[model samples]
Target chain A: MITFENIDVVYPNGFKGLSNVNLQINKGEFVAIVGLSGAGKSTLIRTVNGLVPFTSGTLTVGDVVVDPRSKAKLRRLRSRVGMIFQSFNLVTRVSVLNNVLVGRSADTPTWRSLLGWYRAEDKELAFQSLERVGIVDKAYMRAASLSGGQQQRVAIARVLAQDPEVILADEPVASLDPPTAHKVMRDLRRIQQELGITTIVNMHHLDLARSYADRVIGMRAGEVVFDGPVEEATDEVIEQVYQRSLTAEDIVTAEATQE
Target chain B: MVTTSTAERRAAPQAATVRPEPPRPSGLVYLGLAGLAVLAFIVFWVIQESGDVLLIPLGFVTLWAPLNPVIGLVVMLVALAVCFKARIGTMAAFGALAFIMMSYWAGATVGFTLLEIPERWSNVEPRLMAFLDPNWSYIWTVRDQWLITISMAVVATLVGCAIGLVLAMYASPVSSPNKGTSQTIKAVNSVIRSIPDVGWALLFVAFIGGTAHGLGPMAGILALLMFNIGIVAKLTSETIDAVNPGPVEAADASGATLTQRNRLAILPQVLPGFVSYGLYVFELNIRASAALGIVGVGGIGSAMMLQLNRFQFENVAAILIALIVVVLLVDMFSMYIRRKLL
Candidate 1:
């Protein structure tokens, strides 16, 4: 389980990223977070991995506490909660298999990782993760050579290899095209179903969230305005959460909706 | 399932392609050519003179004269060719003519005859034996001094690179702990870098208040350290600044410690450059060690200088041969390492 209790994040320059936000997500649940730009969706997802620390909050992932004050504790917390980015931040100079193997550093000894000595089991696990993402044949190729959607899949393979309990994907498909975006969303859904990982995705597209998420959490100006199952998340609720009427740009499949 | 469209393949009629002609040189280029022609004619006239009016500027010209009419005719023909070409070759020919003029005025001459040898070769027999004799028995004369010179360079380069690497990390804004630390390191390095290697050597020799030959290799090594630190730190920090930050972020997100992040991400990217820099510093140190001997920091240079001062040309010759052999060996070794790095 992942829990955020009365979390508030205020930057040193006095910008509030999150304010009095509380959320509880059960294991194996798929939740989509929707918000306009600067509405704290990214801050909410990053808080789980302790990538962005909450100023006043108690965040617990499994049994580990997310405490930025203690680096050892923060590292332990990060190991169990994987975060993905819109840019698919893999080291493009390295091979795809080597990019996946970076996940093993959390488990490998410091000396071993420094010397790039991976155990046979870790190598086997990396190959299996690549196979799961259906990019096993491209594992030896450089990550920069892969297409955008393929690179995102390699990133998903990295997360799977880490075997995290809660997967935080912040705008995973925001950079992809319409058809490739649908395919990547299906891959994320399949991975979630097969491994029973708690997956939280921060998405801007309403139709994508409606199609993929079991539950939707809406935010406006650093506070959650709506929280319920997909069926209860009506168009009126989304418009209220964004504090404006929805436009065609707010939906990825707007053409289909218009027809 | 054969889907053939209504598109048909056709060939267009062929015609000759015409390329545009290149632009011609402007009148200004021809003007420059005329100026060069005037300069060459003046130089030819100067070369045929009887005295040293242009000797200093045209030192190479005085060796031969345009005394013969045939030679004068040949020079005029060359000048005419340069006038038409009006290019870099024309400018070069003008320079050659100037040198010929100077040489002719200087009354210079070419010689192939050997000069007489000094009878003091027997007095410089010990230095001669050192080179020709396989046993190198004369090495005992300056055994400790030579060792000090070699060790000073080796140790200084090794420790200097280490210190430089640390300073570079702090000097780089990206990897530094804070902005203040980065600026301070850069400031300190800039101050140290402004001092020349020989200047550092001279300062240390004076500050210690000892004979130039007796203060030990510490003075020389210290000078080398000062020089090496500036070079290595500047090169390394520039390289560190250029590394991709994406991998560093990935390492952080993957729960890597600071050391692990550097080792796995930044180190691999900069290791080759750092090795190349280290080898280059080593070569600089070797050459600088010889130079530091002038200030009496205990190197082969001091020994050779001492031999030359007493008018012992034979001894000086032996020392020069030894220095050349040592420098050649070091250069070859450094070249091999650089090739391997590539």
Candidate 2:
């Protein structure tokens, strides 16, 4: 379980990144967060592992309270809370298998890793994770050599190898084409379900979010305006959150433009 | 696939709509500033030549008569500016510097140059001809010294690279985990870099005695190591910090340890950079070793010092050839390794 108690984030310039936010998420829930760009969606999710520190709040992940994270605690929290990026951050010069193995580092000794000598079982686990994401064949190939979709799958496999308890994906499919984006989101949702990890993903396309999310949380200007199950998330509620009524014509226009 | 160019360029029209961002001055601004520099140079030259601007022919055509060195530079600059669109002005400035340096050397060497050693040959030490006659067989015989010098260069490089690697690893913000700790590492590495190798050898010589003389190679090695260590550590740590945070975050999410994260995420990313840095240090070490001969540090350079001291220009020429060969060889090796690594 993860809990945020009245969390507030104030930047040095006095901009409120997140304002008195409170939320809780349970494991196995595939939550999709929808918001306009610069709507504190990224800030809210990054606070779970203290990637962006919350100025005031009791942000707790299982047993860890993410306030003033000491180096040791931050590492411990970071180890369990995996975050994905739109950029698919794999080391370009290295093999996919080695990139996946990096998800296993906190479990090994420094010297061992330095020598490129990973543990036997960890190696096996990395390969299995690669297989799960269907990029197993590309394991020996350099990360830079893969196609965008394949690299995204490798990223997903890296997270699987991490064996994370919580996964936060920031605009995970933004860089992908619609079809590739759909497949990537589906793969992520399926993996999250299978692993039973709590997953919160930021998404732009409404249809993709509706199909993948167990619960939809909507935000605007650093405030959560709507939170409910997909069935209860009316277009009216989306209008209330977005301050723009998204009609069927709007959807058609969006689809047409995307084409 | 979205093929609509209009949609792809949705934000393109906004460039004109938005409040125009103030454009910074461009290369023309630099060109205007360069005019100031030229004015300054002219003022200095006027003062230097006692207002005799005609003696220093202001243009390219007549400057090389007794060559007002700066005039040659100005000519070169004009030629380069025409050929390379002003890019060569900078090169011309440096060229002028080189010209001044050669002039200085010419002044220093006048007495020595004037001492015309007899062109006649000696049976024991034949006349210094460009040809390596029976008299110059000693250059070939000095192969053992050449090997020893080159070997010393290699040893110095290895030691410096090792220390640099270790310091870099610990001081790296990613591995150290504490900002304060990493800062201290940066500071210590800086101090190590600031201390010169000759100074290090001199200090160590007082403590170690006789260990200092003919120890130019060791001195060169230590110096190369110290300087390279500072560079390598800073570079490697930055490289470590830059290793994409995605893999690290994944490792962390998996409940991995600090050791695990670095091992899994950081090391692989930095390996190529490490090898590249190693090669860079090797090239630096070869060049640096040549200077260690004054303090009796081993290497072909030490022999050059001895020859120069004895005023045996032929022997000095022999040592110079050996040193140049070693340096060039090191350069080739560094290039090959860097090419392969990158």
TM-score of each: 0.63, 0.75
Q: Write the per-residue lDDT of candidate 2 for residues A1-259, one digit (tens) a residue.
A: 8888888988778989899887888768999888778889998888787777788978888877875557677777777777788888787778999888877766667777767888899999999999988878888999999988888888877777777888889888888776788778878888888888899998766777787889999998888878889887777877787788675522211221222
Model 1 CAPRI rating: acceptable
lDDT of 2 by residue, B250-342 (tens): 566555666666666677778889888877777766666566667666665676677778766777666666667767887887788778877
Alpha-carbon RMSD of each model: 11.1, 9.0
RMSD of 2: 9.0
- Interface RMSD (Å) of model 1? 1.7
Superposed on all Cα atoms, model 1 deviates from the true structure by an RMSD in Å of 11.1
**The candidate that achieves the highest DockQ relative to the unseen native structure:** 1
Interface RMSD of each: 1.7, 3.1
Worst 10 residues of 1 chain B by lDDT: B108-117
Per TM-score, the best of the predicted structures is: 2
